[model samples]
Target: MFFMFIYYFLFSWNLAGVFGVDSVKSVSVTEGESVRLNSDLTEIQRDDEMTWKFNNIMIAKLKDSKSRFYEDNAEGRFRDRLKLNDQTGSLIITNTSTTDSGEYTVIGTSTDSTLNIFRLTVYANLSVPVISRDCSSSSSSSNCSLLCSAVNVGDVTLSWYKGNSLLSSISESNISISLSLPLEVEYQDKNSYSCVINNPIRNQITHLNITQLCHMCPDCFHCGSTEAVIRLALSVLVGVAAVAVMVYDIRSRSFQQKREQTSPSNNE
Candidate 1:
């Protein structure tokens, strides 16, 4: 019984050594901002050695009241961006960008080891959504075609909403690219419509102006369509010709009346 207790104690101690007191944390920050990964330590001891790693590659270290930063690691992705706290052994990344997103691990050792893991996610600042008329999609005079667009967005959803109701939505992941969504509405409709672009962190919105966007003529004068331009030109020409014909007719009638009044039969 005494030998069995000794074996059990040894197994438990081995397990503890293998998996030390681990604390995991998740952090998110926008691009061009700073984020700090806490070490959960009140203070660094005299004999404690703390090391910070990015995806298992050493980036920083704190030992004996001195802090060292390896800013050239990870293919120079973290160049000049790492800061280590000598007192608490925390890691601070300044002016972060989307490329600086990944797993971070901090290991501290003295008599025993303690581990703190952090998953960092950095997001780019969102751009305002753009609203425009979709001229090609204007199928009829009563209906108007519209398009909402955003550029250089990643892991975002572009959606069209009508009076708090969802109409259509599209999403993209990982790749940064331009996105556009189309909506069709009636020219005389009086409902509120809006376009939204959102990510996990924040959202951008643009309200739709029905009167300004959905014209009664449906891109006749707004979109500068070739057919509309030709029609305008023909209308101008017709008005000019009608005015010329009217002037000629009025002059001819006046001359005929004067001749009739000056005739000998009229004088007798």
Candidate 2:
């Protein structure tokens, strides 16, 4: 019995591949947008019956030029969002969300059965990329540290760009989480920089303001670099030595004047 069932399944699949099965169509759409799955049929005859299924569960049907939608199916996930075209037996989904992403199949029956498949990917609206200074980084006076981030993102790419050229990039797939990318640039750099987050449907970008974010005071010193700290210490020591020398010279001049006055009095 098991062998017979396996043989029948394989035979059915092979026949489907040979005669009426079409290639799987790829469809991508952003959340809150509408998408249509084509049936590839020019017209539906009076005796034809077409059914739409999602994950192998029927959600819609077209028969005898009449259309029916099972909005309450799939745990009511398709409620008030499904539309069927009786003429071509196509299905349209309105106000789509990320949960709508899945495999959809359509089967038509009359004298011969026909099959059409679609792979749908519904992406959430991309959040704006946030650019901020990375204060925790060991940044030097000559270089600025920065981080670009996005939250609750999936199947997206985060990148840093210099003018129109790509600098660094990171990508994630199949998991929703926060994404962050780091960048470093010279404090006096005049070139334009930007951070971008993108999915298949849309992208978000944030431009970098080098002068504003990378500003450093003229007298500011950085302890992160040993060389810079050593230079600053040498400057402070030089200033203190010069002040001590001037004070010593003034005291010596005063002592000499007092000794000369005392000698003249003693001679008198």
Candidate 3:
């Protein structure tokens, strides 16, 4: 009897595949959006009947040429959110949430068995990542420690990148809360770095410029020490050289005038 039951199950499975219901359709949408699962049927004849299920739990049924929700199916997460079309057996879900992501199947009972399957993936919208510098280090080295964070998100990954090269990444699963990631880089590094927050559907990035931040730190860029001394020395040397040249020119001119006055001129 067990062998017979196995054979029956295999035959039923194969029969389901023969009806073109084996291929799974993929659908992706953002959270709080609406999605429609197409039945691939343009019209349902008067004698046709259809049924829709989510994970094999019937949510909609068509009988006696009338479309309606199955008894006790319009409750919980699906309450007031499911719309069914009687003519085509298509199902539309409104204000979709991440919990609504699942496999939906529509079965048609007519002259030929029809099966349509859809795997729906709903993603939360990515939030803008906030980047902040951590200046708590006691060392004199001006290395910048940056923290990137986002809140109230789910199924996301936070990453740090130097240009196109990925440095670090953190991923969260099924969580809708706050998280953060950090990166430390040298003060003089001119490469472009960015913090990215992403989900399956969207991503947001914030760019960082370490050189700009280092301009204010004396220890990092040597802001006011070396360069300022060099500038001051150059200015003093330039001023002294100008004064000496002026004094030498004046003395030479005065001596020449006196010699010309004392010497007998050819015309005199």
Candidate number with greatest lDDT: 2
TM-score of each: 0.79, 0.74, 0.65
Give the count of colliding residue pairs in each prediction: 0, 0, 0
Candidate 1 Cα outliers beyond 4 Å, as residue runs: 1-24, 111-114, 174-176, 216-245, 266-268
Query: What does candidate 2 score on TM?
Result: 0.74
Model 2: residues with Cα > 4 Å off, grouped in runs: 1-19, 174-176, 216-268
TM-score, candidate 3, is 0.65
lDDT of 2 by residue, 1-268 (tens): 9999999999988887655455677899999999999888899788899999998888998899888988788888999899988889999999999999999999886743546888999999989999877766768758888899987568899999999999999998756568999999988889999999999879999999987777543444541445667787999999999999999999999999889888967779
Between prediction 2 and prediction 3, the one with superior lDDT is 2
**CA-lDDT, candidates in order:** 0.84, 0.85, 0.78
lDDT of 3 by residue, 1-268 (tens): 9999999999989887766778789999998999999898898788788888888788887766686776465346787788887777789999998788899988876644546899999987778888766544322344666678887477888999989999999888757568788777776777898989888778898888776643444444343335555676899999999999999999999999888888877338
Window of ten residues with lowest summed lDDT in model 2: 216-225
Better of 1 and 3 by TM-score: 1
Q: What is the C-alpha RMSD of each candidate to the true structure, in Å?
A: 4.8, 6.5, 9.2
Give lDDT for model 2.
Answer: 0.85
| Residues forming the 10-long window of minimal summed lDDT in candidate 3 | 216-225
